[model samples]
Target: MKIKFLLMIGLFTGSIIYAQDSLDTRPDRARIIGFSPAKNTKNVNGMLIKYYDEIDHEIKPKKVNGVGLGCNGLGIFFPALLLVSIPSIDNWAINDIGGEPLPDKMNKINGMQLSIINMEPTITNGLEVNVSSNISAPSVTNGVAVSPLYNFHHTTNGMAISTFANVSKKCRGIQISLFNVCKDSRGIQIGFWNENEKRKFPLINWNFKNKKS
Candidate 1:
């Protein structure tokens, strides 16, 4: 059973890589966000949170589900942390359409036909630099978007970790590439974007150090 499971895992990862590789044809200008086990304590959380929050705040609801990123959705994205961020009115917005109630538009535009696979975290650098990933093929064939999601975890050393993912269609932006990360003693990071950005936004970062598939 273990052997069969391992083989299946390998094949699934290979397939994601293969499909993503087709869209990553221009590697020269691509952004590379590398993940390494941190030895330094000071810069570790800063870097991790910097990237983590960026993924959480900017990426989560924007891509994973179609809602705007907000404090309420933080835990939804980062289940490992269970941290709830209270949102100000500014964190939310309301728009009016001709004879349409607010809740109706929100219902249709704020949620996605989505499934979240694994969103957990490990500790590091006195923070939870958790990791998470989602596994869902796009539902709409053309120009559909999903909500942004966050994953939180803590390392054995008690470092806080969080991961983020978001997908959407833009009028003038580049394509969004999706893939998985299968290798990392601690975790694997996968990003999505076109060729111009310095980093493809991480849709999921999974920490598999203590767990086995």
Candidate 2:
């Protein structure tokens, strides 16, 4: 019958060229383009072009339920942005860029991240605000990390604030600081110098193991 209508138009032109080669190999969904400053173009998602290496090489966007503005999310690779940074140091060389760090993967950032100066990230679950430093990675933040000077982390579950320092190696929750260190603390440390190799308190420190209910 005319060779089955030329084999059904060659299977509909090979399914429209395999659906345009699967949408050009998927991964691009954030577009608001207008400002251009060079063009390196990769896979960008939402609100494009505003300096910073032309949207920082654009590749992050495995998921971003909503909102993302940037000056430094450190050349994102993956983190599901809800990111907002606008006070640059341009990520402070971000793990020493251009040789070993080019979105060298390992960004979590579930939601809420506001930065004005520094907000390093290797992992973040929710809420991380910075004015100076809120560095992470070694263990990384789970939730809530605020900063005025420093709130470095190696492992923190929740709550870590800093006016001066709130370093951590392992803290379950809460560590407000004028200098609060931790090698291992279960919870609570609000102070003008509260350390914990096991327990050292000048203002307040806790191991907190009360669970009988």
Instruction: Please tell me which predicted candidate would have the highest TM-score against the true structure.
Output: 2
- What residue runs in model 2 are displaced by over 4 Å at the alpha carbon? 1-108, 117-127, 132-146, 149-161, 164-176, 179-185, 188-190, 193-204
> What is the lDDT, from 0 to 100, of the residue 121 in candidate 2?
34
Write down the lDDT of every candidate, Cα atoms only: 0.25, 0.53
Identify the candidate with maximal lDDT.
Answer: 2
Please give the RMSD to the true structure for each candidate, in Å.
Answer: 22.1, 15.6
lDDT, candidate 2, 87-174, per-residue tens: 2332222223212222444334456545543232345577766554433334266888887666666678999987866767678989
For residues 36-155, write the lDDT of model 1, one tens digit per residue. Answer: 121111111111111122222222211122221122234355444422552332321111101211111111112322223222111111111112222111112122322233321111
The TM-score, computed over Cα atoms with residue i paired to residue i, of candidate 1 is: 0.18
